[model samples]
Target: MDDVVQAQTGTPPVRGAEIAVDGLAKHYGSLKAVDEFAINIRSGEFLALLGPSGSGKSTILMMLAGFEVPTAGRILIDGVDCTRLPPQKRNIGMVFQHYSLFPHMTVADNVAFPLKMRGVGRTERRRRAAEALKVVRLDGYGARMPSQLSGGQRQRVALARAIVYEPRLLLMDEPLSALDKNLREEMQLEIKRLHHELGITVVFVTHDQGEALTMADRVAILRGGKLQQLSPARELYERPANLFAAGFIGEMNMIPAQWDGAALTLGTGERMVPPTGAVVGTVGQGAVTLAIRPERLTVCDPVTPDALQATLREVVYAGAGTLLIAALPDGTEIRARVASASLPPALTEGETIGLSCPPEAMLVYGEEAAA
Candidate 1:
């Protein structure tokens, strides 16, 4: 923040805090909501906790916010134990999926609510509130009540209130889920810009993979209360740790097969040689799954060398790309995503065609890793 803004708000620039969650586990009777979850959040980093329903992402976030205490483990914020700290004392700004603004309060008053709670005088509160509203690009809209604003504007007000206190860390729970598609995308960029300007450590929770990929520095993938993988978005998509992660992040084609150390025998008894280190183990032989990304598979002529023959089942036209669904001799289906402009004109439904995925692009995984 610039000196002028800091002077007006009478608050120092916010510095992001590092958080270490060690052996964190939350249990509810017989159910383990979060199991042995551990991760180090870097200072000023935007980290996303992502998972499907019942995956314990919300449980972890609640534990971090002091709304729910863990059954086991510790939460350290900047090396200080905050496991039992009350929500009020944690100095963490939180924005929920719902715009939890007070309908009776004007935007400015809402933004200044935190300062009022801290016992700042009326004049100072107004000054800080105005600056906060300006920071959210609501400049002169502070006098309007929450009911009078659009959904996007209300979300902006919620964000304004979150940062108004100059909290060291920010926690967001799917804050954009309430908006329309375009508005949701717009708010994503807005939050990104705000994070850049404030440089506060942000812990975001969402089930949307696109949001996690677009907004976060690192993504934590969770399932059945256990962490599946945590990595940057690209690596998580390109080199997933297991079959569960590979199938979860995006479109993945999984083929059941038998591996004999050097080659694979598909369900149809077709033989194929895969690159070295295809599977991750010393045994290197057993029931395996050959996984390939839709974009990595190519549709080609039946005469092509090393091609897997299939009958084109359907053609799905997606803007900027086409999804080709093909059925193998054994009736196993696989899809290929190709550029719309690069697709062959002769390709059509029921056309006998050849599909080829390079040996290196095929990801081999043992069957036991299935979700």
Candidate 2:
């Protein structure tokens, strides 16, 4: 934990100089792009802003990076009001999905641009450029142009350029989206390693849940221009704030229901007790929504009396797992994934089976159960 924070500490430590966005709001004509956005980013924390497209995740990032101006609210970095600060004066580093490297310059020249702009001597600039390249593990490729490298390598060069000057905060926008899956995963690890090595505060924005989960020390989820939840990966996964968050962050089976204090009784007469201390709204008595991840559900072969009966709808081989689609007796469809090696025996469409889910794995929400 110390190592994590140390690696993200800026070149000149800004002690207690955290970022605070208070009551941030932005609009475009009649559409509210961001509303009442607020987040406190610690000086050396690796934080991620995650949401679906058009969910205003990137807009908030742009606002923080000085690319977009908020219509309302204030932004403070290290307790300094920087809401109106120009991008160049912010002393922030940024990289984006497009690999915004200088196509005309060699990798070394590109990396040295920031140091040179900051008036470093020629020798020191070249030395820092070499070190940055080495940090990205691309030392010998300094002579290559952006076109000479693969997508991942080009992004690394972009990263090196962003960090060569050791800015106080680093912003990345979908930096790995252009790479192939394997390369993306490799670069994700590399970014995490670099973040650990540099200790520069990072504000990462991405729509990829896996990327957010793998990299961020904490994640802030956005939806409809509002923050839905901000928490550690495990907490966000285990306890989403609402139906939108629960459904968006991962695969879930949402069932409609009527809340009766302790248990939710479905229209089909099925009842589910939530995990202890789970918060279900008071207005949820008439109608409520319940969510359960696919992996938490099990198929019972012997047709147990209490198990919900479902008909196997489809089976798909998903490399590491077999995905099964089942519909309950009342036409409620649910998806579940069983380990591929443990694929059920010859289950076919239309075969009736029973399924069971532990109470602890269920999540209930919404005013009326969602169908």
Candidate 3:
């Protein structure tokens, strides 16, 4: 608990609270912003609510923080119903994408405001403020005004203020979205370190897949106000439940195919076998979509058996690897990522090639699944 201030006298350490959201729903007139949302977040775990804009992730966060009332359902924290509680009474900390620091206040004053609101003594407030600043790696900058700090520093200040009161749960709404690439990556590590040291249950909301995958213990993906899938990062990437989950979590190439229970037939009359334990919805589905990640494809000789024939169309040079764009016999584009050093020297544009994809690496979804 390095990030937490030591107990004073007889005070006990703060423990994280478990959160359970059951049938949570929000409606604005006829608009259903969030519907039938449910998940149980374990104590001391980091969970990410991931989705694109208008997917209702932000609305869910607002409801959880008690800033918005749900149209139906309930929220329980550590077995206590808090669905109707005010934000101040919930005892939860929140950090927003924009650092919502008081520009008129010094860093220390900003961090101490929460304690002051609770009517703590001045001396105790200052001591806890200093300790919180130290936890955020800004020990000597307490006297500086918010305007004097950089973006990342200001965000850290906001984080310090949110946690200074020792809240058992923390909610971050895309807190790193405003930072540059390098700084965002740096803060992600810092947030992870703080979560480990504080043992606070954190619920992070973001639209960036990379950020969610990098920092979350588990990720819940939402689309159109509905949960697409909830799983660890690796499982979400390798085994998406539907077409939207497959397309949203990472880059995927969807190929239209016909399914006949035992095998799939491509438009080019090529018969393909499904991977063992493939998640094809029922045995008798007619039209299906085959999903294969670019990284799962391998380029082979044109004459290779049991391989899809393609014509190399373009070579994209990325520093660490190369992206090969090819066209199948039916004109469907296929993409393959290969290490730069592993690319064949003789491969060139407009040359015939064979693409091999293991059945186990492929995902099949029904054609009617939401995109």
Candidate 4:
């Protein structure tokens, strides 16, 4: 984690190929699919628009790709207003969840489709397609038909086609959703590698938390068609802006609490201060919420100082780790994770236990009405 922070210090400034969007809004028959959305995308950076269905993540991507018109606001790429630009004119490559490859065309021909549309000569198109395939590690599979290739290979072909023209911006709409878990992880790394090796600005859209966290340099989280938070992956994970962000980013132990001027008192009568309490100020007494990640909570014998007593409700083994759902004396549930090797042997359910985490690990947020 220290290395992760140090790596941030060396991050390059926003490149010139930046994207500027302001007050972008879209609607359909009074349904606000995208509402006053705005974000600045750094050039050569891998940014992900992450949210569940109907959260307008894809709408934002479509607007940026010039497929959907925004009813309000403006879009600028490299300081040039592209609000009225056509899809093809935007020079943005798009890859969707579906392969969208031509069944009749071989991999080479499919990769060459964009080049041919751009009026490149057959010889040059073939050469460029070959180069693009090499970039995706599909060099020799050029002549193979889509039917002959596996799902992952077909997706690689789609990726190769998208990059064949060397577009300045790349737009992906859940491109790896159709693949199995193992293949999806492989492609996530591949896409990340491509983004770095090509230095192309990418605006990836996905609802998968793990996918967004693993591949994106920055994640833009949306809810109800509005931006909730935008920040680097670790920051968003460890310091979510609100309850929605806390629950969406990862597995969290959300417990009711009340905040005093100096500290937040959990339902279990345990008090903890946020990592950045100074920035958020001391939340005064009243309803509030404390967010803690499962892995942040510590479970052990001898109830360390500052630990809240709890009862071990159950322990579920998850191969790499064990998830313990425990209940505090006050009836507040907290989740804790321990390495599989460190899990207690034959621990009985409903056993009295203690759960504790460093004060800095706590995230406090004001409660909000259910949406």
RMSDs, each prediction? 2.5, 3.4, 2.4, 5.5
* lDDT string, candidate 3, 243-322, tens digits: 88888988898888888877888888899888667754444458888889999888887788878899999999998899
Candidate 1, run of 10 with poorest lDDT: 1-10
Off by over 4 Å in 3: 1-3, 6-14
Name the top lDDT candidate: 3
* Residue 302 local lDDT, model 4: 32
Question: Where does the lowest 10-residue lDDT sum fall in candidate 2?
Answer: 1-10
Model 2 lDDT on a 0 to 1 scale? 0.82
lDDT of 4 by residue, 1-371 (tens): 12212223565322326899999998998999999999998888889999989999998889898989889999999988999899989888899999999999999999999988989999989988888888788979998999999999999999989988877788999999999999999999999877776777899999999999999999999998999999999988888877788888889887887777567777767776656562232355688777778898777673677777888888899998899988888987888998888766677898887677887787777655222
Which candidate, 1 or 3, has the higher TM-score?
A: 3
lDDT of 2 by residue, 312-340 (tens): 88988888888889887678898887788
Which candidate do you rate higher for lDDT, 1 or 2?
1
Residue range 1-371, candidate 1, lDDT tens digits: 24327534656445699999999999999999999999999998999999899999989999999999999999999999999999999989999999889889999999999989999899888987887788888999988999999999999999989988788799998899889999999899998878877788999999999999999999999999999999999988887888889889989999888989888999888889888766643335778988889899887888798888889999999889999999888899989998888888767788888888888788788866665
Q: lDDT of all the models against the reference?
A: 0.88, 0.82, 0.88, 0.83
